[model samples]
Structure formats: C-alpha cells, structure tokens
Target: MIIELESVFNTEGLKLPFDYELDLSAIQVSGYSPIAQPVRVSGKVENKAGIVNLTGNAQVIYTAPCDRCATEVSKEYNFPLEHTLVVALESGENDAFLEVPNLRLDLDELVEEDVNLALPSKYLCNEECKGLCMSCGKNLNEDQCNCKAPVDPRFAALLDLLDE
Candidate 1:
C-alpha cells in the first residue's frame, strides 16, 4: 500500500490514521524460512516538523520449526513498529530517500521488517525439550533410543588418563 504523503507533507500538524490488513503467507523471508500469516496493521502517520513519524501495531501468526525438537509449531506474535521518515526535497539529493524512493512508502517492506525484528533467534517448544537422538534419529522427547553413544578416538587417551 502506497500512501500519498502530499497532504501530510504540506501541513505540519496533519495526521493520517491508517488500518491495513495484508496477507504475508506467500511472502518468504530471507534468513527466516517461516512465512507469516495474514497480519493486521493499524497505525497513525503524523507529519510534524517536516518529519513523518509512523507508529503502529502489527499482529501476525508465524510458523517455524522448533530449534530443539524440529517440530513445526505455529505461534502468534505482535510487534510495535515506530519509525521516522523524512521526505526528501529531491529524489537523489537526500541520503534517507536514496535507498528508498521519495514520497512513496513501501508498506510491505515495513511490515516485513517489523515481523523479522520481532522473531526470536531460537524457538523451542519447551525449555526442557529433549530434542532428537543423533545416533538413531529418534525423537528423545517421546522415547529413548537403544543406540550406543559414539566416543571420539581422540578422547580415548583422556579417558585413560582420568582412570589413572
């Protein structure tokens, strides 16, 4: 959604309250493989002192594999996004608008960024999750595997030293 900032930009005290819902299930984030479900974003954009201040709340459902157990899990996340966008007088004159085009705000990009920042670095179903057994590829949380644990040959000398 591209909001025209002409009105807000011209007036100092102008504010635009916007409510937008977007479907992000089809969009794929780079590092985060999980896709977000349709999200509701409601926010206010205020133009004060020649700066556009946007503050909003977004609610999204995220589906990702658990880090410990490797099970697919769906979680709901809400993130608050607040940022200042300065309108450039010219297209290439200002550094802020250099990366992004002037006067046009990419709502999709902003929403994607907010979702990415809200995600956790690591996700686990539970803190005490036993994860999976490497030897037999068994889910340790369900049951124990009968396979014996392998010991490194380099650690054999250390084991003998500990015995002495």
Candidate 2:
C-alpha cells in the first residue's frame, strides 16, 4: 500500500488512515522467521504543520521453538507504531526519518521496520525453563536427570577439602 500523502502533505489537522499487510518472511532473526501469519498494520497518517506522522499498530502471530527447551512457543505482538515521514531530507543516513519517495509512503516497508524493532530478540517458553540436561540430553523440565554434572578440575581441590 502506497499512501498518497500529497494532499495532506502541507495541510494541518489532516489525517489519512492506511492499511497494509507486511510480509516478514524475507527477514530472519536468530535462525528463524518468527511470523507465522501476515503482519497486519492498520493506522493513520497525519500532517501536523507540514510534519507527516504515521501512528498505528502492527500485529502478528509468531510461532517458533523456545530458545532453551525446544518446545513450541507462540506469541502475538501488537506493537505500537510511530514514524516520521519525510519527502526528502538533507541526509538519508539518519534512521529517524522514513523517506517518502515520489510523494508516497510505502506502508508495507514501514510496518516491516516497525515490527522488526518491536519483536523481542529472544523468545522464551517460560521464565523458569530449566532447559535440557547436558549429559543425558534430556529435557529437564519433563524429567530430572540422574547424571551428575562433573566437577571442573580447578574446583576439585576445594571439593576434596570439603570431603575431608
């Protein structure tokens, strides 16, 4: 969806609502594409005294395995969206501005960028996940392992002192 903002580019108190579905499969983070469904972005763009502002929410259903236990984890992200739209800037290096090329703003691009920023770097099945036992290769959450963790050689002397 390319928003036609030329009408409201210079008008104050003018708002135009835009809807778009952001495809996030192209980008991968942490060896997984978290988006199981299309990221729905519904919001509006307003020009306030020549400043084009986009405000909305990007929502998606993320399904992936937990970082620790390898169990399936699902998350719904309704990320708040706020962006500054500009026709042209002195420099394109700044991250703060979203350049509106040819008098239009790409809604899909904006939503993708916003959702990327909002998603968590790490996904957890739960806060207290015990993960897998190193020795037995068993999920600790499901069953306790009988294999004891081997003591490091550096700590062997101190451990022997306790045994004495």
Candidate 3:
C-alpha cells in the first residue's frame, strides 16, 4: 500500500488520519509458505516543518511452524510502526513546502519486517520439551529408545582429565 504524500506536503502542520487493511499472505518461512492474515492499520500522518511523521498500529495473524518440533503454530501478533520522512528542500523554497518525489510506502514490507523480527528464535510446543532421541530417531517425550550407543575414543582423554 503506497500512501500518496502529495497532500501532506502541500500543507504545513497538516495532520491526516487514515485506516487501511492489507493482505500479506505470501511471506515465506523455513522453505514453507505461511499465510499471513489481513492486517488492520490505523494511523495519523503529520507534516511539521517539512517533515512527515507517521505513527500507527498494525494487527496481524500469523501461522507458522514451531522451531523445535516442526509442528504448526498459529498466533496473532501486534506491532506498532512509527517513522519520519524528511523532505529535501530546494534552493529558495522556504515558504513553499517541498514536494517529495515519488514518495511511496510499502505496507507489506513493513509488516513482514515487524512480524519476522518479533518472532522468537526458538519455539516449542511446551516448555519442558523432551526432544527426539539421537540414537534411534524416537521421540523422547513420548517414549525412550533402547539403542546402544558407542562412545567416541577421542573423548577418553577428556573423561580422564575430568576424573582427576
């Protein structure tokens, strides 16, 4: 969603309130496509002293895989976006509000950035997650595996050192 800044640039100390909804369902994560629900954004843009400041709140629903177990997880996320756009003034244009050339703001990119940044680095279905067994590829949380594992000979020196 590209908001036109022409009107804001024309008037000094102008404040415009707007509400918009955007669909951002095509964002990819972990080699899978996760559908991002429609996000509602409402904010005010104010032009003060040749600078445009935008402050808004965005609400989004995201569905993705759990980091630990690769299970699907769905949740709603809310992010607040605020930024300022500075307009470059031309020579001898003090009274005249300088026009911002091709001022376009991408709502999708902004939402994606916020959502990705907000996501936790590690996600598990439960806090006490007993991960899969390394030997037989069994889920340790559900059941234990009985496969005998061989010890690496290189660790013998370290084991002896610890005993000392």
Candidate 4:
C-alpha cells in the first residue's frame, strides 16, 4: 500500500489513518516461512508542529520450528511502528527517519521491515526445553534417552583406578 503523504506534510494537525493486512507468507526467516497469516497494520500519520510522524502497530501469529529440537511452535508477535517522515534530509546518514521522496510512502515495506527486525533470532518451545538427545536423536522433552554422556579419553585411566 502506497500512502500519499503530501497533504499531511503541508497541513499541521492533519491526520491520515490507515489499516490494512499485508501478506508475508513468502518471507522466509531462519529457514522457515513462519508467517501463517496476513500481518495487520493499523496506524496514523499525523503532522505535529510541522513534523510528520507515523505511528502504528503490526500484529501477527506465526508458527515455526523450535531452534533446538525442530518441534513446531506457534507464537504471536506485535511490533510497534514509529518513524519520522521526511521529505528530504540534510545528511543521508540518518536512519531514524523514513524518506518519502515522491510524497508516497510504502506501508507494506515499512511494516515488513519493522516486523522482521523485531522477530526473535531463536524460537524455543519453552524455557526449559531439553532439546534433542545427540546420540539417539530423540527429543528429550518428550522422553529421556539411554545414551550415556561421553567420557573424555584422558580421564579413562583415572576411571579405571576407581574400578580397581
């Protein structure tokens, strides 16, 4: 969705409201397409004392595999979107503002970027997730495996002394 911000840029105290669903099912994160539904973005672009600002929230529920055990996990994510809209900037190094060069802002791009940045790098099924047992490839969360922990070869002679 391209939002025309020319009117809001010119008039102080003017507000433009926007609400839309953006489909992001094709976006892959951490080797999985976690987004199961369209992201709901709703917010307003307003001019406050000659400064245009965009404020809104993006929400969605995504399901993906757990980082450790590969178990499917579903999570809801809500991201707050806030940015200063600028027609032009004196310096190009500022990332704090969104530039609307042609008086049009791409709402989908902004929301997608924000949501992607806010997502967690690792997803866990639970805080106490035991993950998978390395030797048997069994999920420890579901069942404990009979594999013993590997002993270091340097400590083998010391272990023999205990047996004697």
lDDT of each: 0.74, 0.80, 0.67, 0.88
Candidate 2: pairs in clash: none
Top candidate on lDDT is 4
- Best prediction by TM-score: 4
Off by over 4 Å in 1: 29-33, 89-101, 147-164
* lDDT (tens digit, per residue) of candidate 2 on 4-103: 8888786888999867677787767777777867888888999888788888988888888888789988888799888788888765458777778687
Tell me how candidate 1 scores on lDDT: 0.74
True lDDT of residue 11, candidate 1: 87
Per-residue CA lDDT of candidate 3, range 66-115, in tens?
65455577767677877665466667765324244576656557656766
What TM-score would candidate 1 get against the native?
A: 0.70
TM-score, each model?
0.70, 0.80, 0.63, 0.86
> Candidate 4's residue-wise lDDT over 1-164, tens digit each?
98999999999999999998999888798668899788989999999999999999998888998877989988888899999999887676488887889999989988888988888887898888888875577998898788898344467668888889
**Could you give candidate 1's per-residue lDDT for residues 1-164 as a string of tens digits?**
87777788788999988898887776554455575567898898888887778888888877877787788888877788787776444555543332234667787788777786777777887779888865566888899888787444468668879999
Locate the minimum summed-lDDT window of 10 residues in model 1: 92-101
Q: Model 3 misses residue 41 by how many Å?
A: 2.6
Query: Sort by TM-score, best first: what order?
Result: 4, 2, 1, 3
